[model samples]
Target: MTLLDIKDLSVTFNGTPPSPPVRAVDSVNLRLEAGETLAVVGESGSGKTVTALSLLGLNPPEPVCTTTGSLRLDGTDLRTLGDKEWRSVRGRRVAMVFQDPGTALNPLLTIGTQIADAVRAHERLTREQARQRTIEALEQARMPEPESRLRQYPHELSGGMRQRAAIALAIAARPKLLIADEPTTALDVAVQAEIMAMLRSLCVDLGMGLILITHDLGVVAEQADRVAVMYAGRVVESGPAAHVLKRPRMPYTQALLAATPRLDAAARTRLVSIEGQPPRLRDRAPGCSFAPRCPVAVDDCTAGVPPLAVFDGDHAAACLFADAPVELPAARPASAAASEPGPAPTTDGPSPLVEFDAVDLRYPVRSGALRRVTGHVHAVQGVSLRVEAGRTLALVGESGSGKTSLTKLLLRLERPSGGTVRYDGIDVTRPGPADLRRLQREVQVVFQNPYASLDPRLTVRRILAQPLRVHGLDSDEDVLVGLLRDVGLDSFALDRYPSAFSGGQRQRIAIARALALRPRLIVCDEAVSALDVSIQAQVLNLLADLQAEHGMAYLFITHDLAVVRSVAHRIAVMRHGRILEEGTAEDIYASPAHEYTRELLDRAPGRRDAPVAPRFSAAGDTGLSPTTTPASQHTNKERSPLWRR
Candidate 1:
């Protein structure tokens, strides 16, 4: 049975005065069957979230926003429901799991209290009954020690635990439908697998329909029964997951697949990037919304909007050239030349740019109102690693595995409790004022969220110029323009604020600023994890090119193993604040020595060896072979003594 059906749904947000109303979600159509999963895939601001919000009637009402067309739930019309009616339908019949559980869940309330409150909202149960039901729900969501978690607040739980709690709250009333928006976006690979498995089990056991809103194609491939590809407020394609992923009819879908980094792909392999950004709501042109960015687009594509025409089975595409043969850019070989020439190498031989020697970082665990130190939280322990000049060493680990703490030690943001952090043979655990200034010039960092890191008030020129000014370098307009050009942006972006740019563009601005000081080592702390697949591809390619030209080393820190496969020459697996395994990327992927490393690789989604349909291939491609290095050539240091125990 069709659990939910949406037809010709158009959601528009009204603007004030001179500004025109924006049609955020335009004439979108989708359907979800009982006990089935429907995945909605799209880049940021592509109406995926807007459409999801509409399902719950969360959009602004009246003159502020307008919603039209059919929205039905189990043969009942949802559009006709009033505010009071929606309250009964929301938690009782349908529920939603937001992306960030930290914000979605009240920080002050205990997990049991929040879930019990939600349970009480839709049902007339006694306080004790609601509490018991909360524990049952947590158990159903597969949260460990469900009863013990009741007293813990949101902050007290780990990221995975928080997400599980969020899921439990959503399912407390056992709704017929569940909506998960980027549910596992921020989680590590192992935790993500567990969450996805738990959600699938819930769908089967509860007979609930699920609508998964996400940008990760890997998750879609693994979890989604059907796929809906959205772009610029419209469904560009929709079909069975296999058909859409393997034989994608829409250019946008194909481009997204192509841009996604594959685990099978070799290190330093260039990714295919979409040329332009999605059109702004106000600047939307007529005809196909993706026509401007579509590589196969012709003059007729812009003549008028293309209808979602069904061809092979239920597979549909809103493109004029859906049936025609289209050429997609392939992943370039590792030998591809950089865009510009860089300065000659200053160092000779296999000199280490950055080194962590038996590093141990510990924070004092305080107790009582007096804040007396009772013990220590060992964040990093006996982790010895080195990054050679121009090499990329990927530090892969789960949250709280001491990855950030290691980076902090390297950047001199925190001094190690034990061991030395050396930069070019100089111990940086404690440096003089002059040495500190020099260290700052040579080291730079790019954080996960560019919007949070960048100052919204400052213009792009000012952001880039501030670093140059601090270093007493040439802060002229020409130098700034050159920095922008290096990152594939024009001079017109200089005067615009960070808010005006997309997530990808804001990161480029951040990179441009990082480049201002001519840093030797760039610490990318989960930089591309927040971006769309296409945008991530662009940024990865940009980073690869910059590294090739400038001969700079990268301390690439992330939990994404597929991305690790695409960029890292060496791999270091961290857990419990120690290096569990370290080797060449090839050696680690081919034959992981440690059990933990194998578990990580196994849990990672979108395995090429899976029985699912093959990845979308480019024309005249014989497949890019992964470049490998002998294990003997790449050093594997001794493990920490704690690992033996």
Candidate 2:
């Protein structure tokens, strides 16, 4: 049976005078069967979230926002439901999981209280009954310790634990339909695998339909039964996951697949970046929204919007020439072919750019109202590593694995409890005032979220100029323009604030600021993890080009193994605050020595060797069979004792 059906749905936000109303979601159509999984994919502002919000009647009021057309759930028209009626349907029949659990979950309330409250809202359960239901929900979500996590607040839990708590809350009322928006965007690969597995299990056991909204194609390939590619507020393509991913009819879908980095691709391979940006909502043209960026677009494509043409089975695409033969770029070399040995590092070469000799970092653990010290949280253990000049060293690990702590030692943000940290042969662990100033100028960092890093109040010129002015360097217009040009931006961007630019553009601004002081070392801390695949390719290419031109070394820290394979020359696997394996990327990828390293590789989604289970059968069966080996069974083997602290 159809769990949810939407046809000719349009959402428009009203604008003030002199500005046209913005149609965020345009005449969209979608359907989901009970226990089926549908994935909605697009860039940041492509109407994915707006369409999901429309289902729950979460958009602005009638005057500020206008919604029209059919939205039905289980044969009932949802568009006609009033405020009180909608409230009853929200958590009982449907629930939504947001991208950032940090924002979705309440910070002041305990995990148990929040889940219990949600349970009590939809059912006439007593306090004890609600508490038991909350515990059951957490266990069903595969949380480590459902009973012990009741009193912990959101801030006390790790990223993965917090997300699991959010999932628990969403499922507390046993909603039949679940909508998850970028559920694992910020999680590590291992944790991401666990979450996806748990979600798949829930769909099978509870017979719930799932709508997954995300930009990560790998996760879609592994988990989604059907795919809907949205662009500029329209469904450009939709079909079975296998057919759409393997034989995409739309240019946009093909471009996205081509741009995604694969684990088998050769290192330093340039990714194909989509040329222009998506059309703005207010300035949307009459024809296809993607016509401006489509490679094979012609005059006819701009004449009128193309209808969704159905061809092979249920596969369909909205394009004038969906059957036309197009030439795709050649595939990158395989790992075996690209593993040819390069010049090996030797002691005779110039001194290492950065070195950590038996380093250790520990934070004092405190408790009670008086905040008395109990023990210590060993964030980093004795670890020795080296990054040669003009090279990229990837530090790979899961959350709470001490990856960030090592970077803190290198940046001198925290002094090590043991051993020495040397930068250009200078002892950086405890540098004097003069040496600290020099270190600051020579070492720069690009953070994970550009929106949080770049000041929203400042324009592009001011953001870039602030760094140069601090170092007493030239902050002239010519220099600023040159910086923008270096990162593939024009001078027109100088007057615009950070909010005006996309995620990729803001990251470019951050990189330009990092280059203002002519730093020799750049620390990219999960920089590209949050961006779309197409934008991620563009940023990675830009970073590679800049490094080649300036001969700068990079400490690229990330949990994305596929991305690490494409960029890093050397790999270091850290877990439980210790390095388990370190070697050349080729050697490590070919034959990993440690069990943890192999587990990380095996859990990475979208690998050719890994086979995905079929989500549905030929008889139109929507129910999926649970995996024989539950993901929770591996918890004890994968998790370390340190995580308990």
Candidate 2's residue-wise lDDT over 488-587, tens digit each? 4668789989987765568778877887787889998887776777667656765665455456788998878888987787999999899999998888
- Give RMSD (Å) of candidate 1 vs. truth: 7.7
Clashes of each: 0, 0
| C-alpha lDDT values of all predictions | 0.81, 0.80
TM for every model, in the order presented, reads: 0.86, 0.87
Candidate number achieving the greatest TM-score relative to the actual structure: 2
Best by lDDT: 1
**Residues 105-190, model 1: lDDT tens digits:** 99889999999999999889999999899999998776878998998898776656787889899999999999998777657898
C-alpha lDDT (0 to 100) for residue 478 of candidate 2? 77
What does the lDDT read for residue 206 in candidate 2? 88
What pairs collide in candidate 2? none
The local distance difference test score of model 2 is 0.80
- TM-score of candidate 2 on Cα atoms, chains taken together: 0.87
